[model samples]
Target chain A: MFNAIVSAGTLGTALDSVSVLVEECKIHLNDDGIAIRAVDPANVGMVDLTLSEAAFESYEADGGVIGVNLSRLQDIAGMASSDDLVHLELDEETRKLHISIDGLEYTLALIDPDSIRQEPDIPDLDLPATIVLEGRDIDRAVTAADMVSDHIALGVNEDDEQFYVDAEGDTDDVHFELDRDDLIDLTAGPAHSLYSLDYLKDMNKAIPSNAEVTLDLGEEFPVKFHFDIAEAEGSVTFMLAPRIQSD
Target chain B: MFNAIVSAGTLGTALDSVSVLVEECKIHLNDDGIAIRAVDPANVGMVDLTLSEAAFESYEADGGVIGVNLSRLQDIAGMASSDDLVHLELDEETRKLHISIDGLEYTLALIDPDSIRQEPDIPDLDLPATIVLEGRDIDRAVTAADMVSDHIALGVNEDDEQFYVDAEGDTDDVHFELDRDDLIDLTAGPAHSLYSLDYLKDMNKAIPSNAEVTLDLGEEFPVKFHFDIAEAEGSVTFMLAPRIQSD
Candidate 1:
């Protein structure tokens, strides 16, 4: 049995982060907290989310996994205001999830966990370059690049000690460069990778503009973005595989 | 020759009024003011708009008719803020209309006046009932009715001394009524008409919420809605033919 109360904003952000990667996920609940790890169907992106018991207003649970439909949860979340408190409860007999916001209650049938795809194991990588900066800075660069091209190259200029995002179109190109002084922290190294902007654009929507985000990059390897949620009571990590660059 | 400067809001409102009915029209410019009269292609609605010379910051013209594409004008107007000044000039030599706003100039090719549809003569009708109220009041009723039905009935109740807007669906209905105290004025004579909500919805977008609107109604007859524009420096009239009510 499990029952909890959390701020609507925090629950909505967590659902949004996972919905971008997959439509369904198995949320594991225990005395410690709730956690989810899933990968996209194309195997190009993966998401990891965790919320501590402190993140909830009230928490009580027996360790178990509940399969959830993220899209339906997102729709219910859309009806709530940011500061509204959301109550969630599991009905073991009916195998349903009860969500309450304000005076409205929504009961959604839970998916069978055995029917869902097996979770992916987190891969280990030795990325050499890392940068930390405000989420808005990366959001701005992604928006500008989307207007010019479908793919963007992220690279660290060791000689100039700057990180740059560049997009080249048939008729025009957009480029944004930020030095160490402009970023919160930078460990510059020879690292460059090309990635599809489509996934990045969707992921950008879940990021809070003023929050700090850390990016890990390497030559022709997957990229990792990490950020805190629920006022740092929880954390989320998004990993996206790089697309092969074409000359 | 014609050269004038008007607030972007005034110009936008004028274009919006005409674009609702027809895409192209003949604008009459004289020493008195600017005017347009056109009917929709389906002949179900007609729009008449007039703006006095005093409405513009500067006005000069040699009386003539210029064919205009209202949709194109709307696009240009959309780029300007409401308070920005818009300069309009007729280039007879080039047979084009030049619109300048905020250092951006857009030149559009004009359609031949002779190739456009002939202007319609204003119909004369004797309506038994007239109601004057805030535009927002009528706008609200229309919006609510749209969700329940495809057509709405507008009438005055002599017994209750009130006016009402009502819509009935297969299983649901919506009604809004206002008494004399709630209206600016009311000439309560027995009147009722059923009109398609599609046209009313489109026209509602052009009506400023805070302004006053006068509606004239008659049994099974066309309805007339009159409102002021450009801060009361001009006026616009919309007439819509009533639909045959199905019992």
Candidate 2:
């Protein structure tokens, strides 16, 4: 059970609209240190992530069966290169992790096994507002919001057939909406909530720009995104804590 | 008129870098519908690149003059998102180039580009032996090659201070040297060549584990990377045509 605020920061950069799913993710022990194995499948979009042996030089693993640090493992996964020396190791006594590649001879420690925690269990939500839109549309709306503001407001009107994402900080407050009919589905009963720009930015990496994405949303509950990674069917869901408004 | 290649065949992936010198580049119209942007400042490293935008949508340039087919543009810049769009116009015939934040958008037309006409040309390099490595490694020998293959060599010499990248095919053979000293320098040479795998992967985006990066070379000719792209830079020295293969 491991959860982390691991962000690939893929949105606005290259990946958008689609969903990423890690079907089988785990932390194991190896001769070197703790090893992490995640089969993440997402569309082969415009971005190709790679890493050199040196970039993953520093690793840490302990225990008879080393513990896995999901975030650090994700970091190393994010830097994978085609020609990289890709290998993972686990510890035996402390249950920590270690990572290394063939290029860099020395194996580096990744992180403390204790730092990684499980994703906060999401309460069963009977959401008041939900909408289904093309992964590409949300990607576009993010672009529009990017034009001026970083803060995005997610809301729904009781009678309206769509959901909206509006960024008011910029002069051109981008209003992105997918009408009920336009969306695969919509259950709008009235809701409102907001989040900062960063969480969305980080969340983008986990989501693809092509899948038909579903928004499991409510006024302030963690916005849930459901989509597929690639040929390997998987999902990367992030629940960002709401940004309490100061004003 | 200057001719360079920047398309799906040659410049095979995303082409941008921050740590290196190549900050900006331009492209324009030619009979073949391509222009060259040389890095006279030796700040350019994207030549013969190749990458593709797997899933892209269509959009018109807002209030811009240059009207180009969206799909055609992908052959040049791969996928783009409006959120990352920068309204760049060249004179009245304007064009909008959406790029990653780390990317510098340089738009130029082939009205009359700076010329590069070598008297004898850079001598038709007779590329001999060549081989295919990971397209991502052309820039990341620092850890994968440098730190590991401190000594560079083509044939198996247990005690040679080097390893070479070779690709032998119907066309030219590509070769790259990675000696301990050479690797030491090449790591730093990223500046001299203004090349960074991190950035190249960002702009032209190629395959990580799938795409095979081909290398070509001779005893004394500059190493040539055979990639696929639909465009090229200009007459400036943004790209380096090997002078001679020597330490």
Candidate 3:
């Protein structure tokens, strides 16, 4: 059983993060908080999200797992104003989730958790570089890259102590760089990697423009993006597999 | 030949006012100003627009008529910010309109004015009722009415001295009323008419929310909407034929 009340903005952001990768996800509910881990069907990207009890106005839960359709939740959330208080309650007997906001009520049928794909184990990676910047900075870079190519290269120049994004098209290219002075923080290391712009574009939508986002990278390896939500009460991390370059 | 410089916002508004009725229009240019009159193919709606020399930052013209593809002009206008200055020059030798904004330049081939549809003669109507209100007020009414039906009735109640918009759908109805206190001005007359919402919706997009719009109506007659553009230096009038109600 689980019940909680949260601001629409917080709920929308959390749902958007997971929904970008998967339409359906298994939500793990516990006395301490809620957790969701999902990967896109193509296996190109994955998202791990956790919302602590502190993220909610009120919360109560007995450890359990439930499958939910993220798209449906997004629609209901779309009806609410950012500041509106959203109340959610799960009915164990009926296997449905009850949602209420400003007198409007909706009962969303939940899927059996056992039917969902098994959650994968989170891999342990010791990346060599770390960079922190405002979400909008990276979002803008991703947008510019999309205009030039389907994939973008992200790296750090150790000598210059700078992070850069580069996209090369058939005849055109785009390059963006942010030095230590421009970034919140930077750890220059061997961090050159290429990733698909499609996945990055989708993930960027979930990040609030003003939020500080951390990126961890390694040569030709997956890039990890981490950002706090709900005033740092909750957090989300996205991992995107790199595209091997061909000569 | 014609040469002019105007703010993107003023030019965009002028083009939008005419483009909504016809995709191709004959622009009549003279030393004093510019004028356009066009009717939709279905003859259900008509637009008359005028922009004086005062509307532009710089203006010069020799009396001439040029046919233009509005959709192309709109695309060029879309590239400019509302406050940006847009330059237009007619290259008589090439019969092209040279448009430049913020260093970006485009030359649009002009259509032969003789090849386009002949201009329509605007009918003179003696509508008895006159009402003036904020563009947003009517826009809201139109939006609400759209939710209920395809056609909306616009009328002024002589006894109540109020103007109202009403729509009836298969299962629901919407009604909005504004008396003298709620309007900028009102002159009651026998003015009850039904009009297609499709036309009003398109016309509403060109009306600035803060603009003071004047409406002239009569019993079962076409309704005329008049509003100023370019800070009163230009004006647009839209006339829509009423959908006769069959009892």
Q: For each candidate, how many residue pairs have backbone atoms clashing (under 3 Å)?
A: 0, 123, 0
lDDT (CA) for every model shown? 0.87, 0.40, 0.90
- The deviation in Å at residue A172 for candidate 1 is 30
Going through the candidates in order, state the TM-score of chain A alone for each one.
0.96, 0.59, 0.97
Off by over 4 Å in 3: B1-247
Worst 10 residues of 2 chain A by lDDT: A43-52
Clashing pairs in 3: none
Docking class of 2: incorrect
State which docking tier applies to candidate 1: incorrect
Which one wins by TM-score: 2 or 3?
Answer: 3
Q: Which tens-of-lDDT digit does each residue in B165-236 have in candidate 3?
A: 999999999999999999999999999999999999999988899999999999999999999999999999
Q: What TM-score would candidate 3 get against the native?
A: 0.55
lDDT of 3 at B153: 97
| Candidate 1 lDDT tens digits, A1-247 | 8999998888999999988888999999888889999998888888889998999999988898999888777766665678889888998998888776643445667899987777877687879999998999989999999999999899899899899999998899999999999999999887999999998997888788998999999999998999999888899999989999877
Report the TM-score of candidate 2, chain A only: 0.59
lDDT of 1 by residue, B1-247 (tens): 8899999999999889888888999999887789999898878888889999999999998798999888888888888999999999999998898999988999989989998898988788889999998888877777666655899899999888888888776533556788899899999988899998988987788788887999989998999999999988899999999999878
Candidate of highest DockQ: 3
What stretches of model 1 exceed 4 Å from their correct place? A1-247
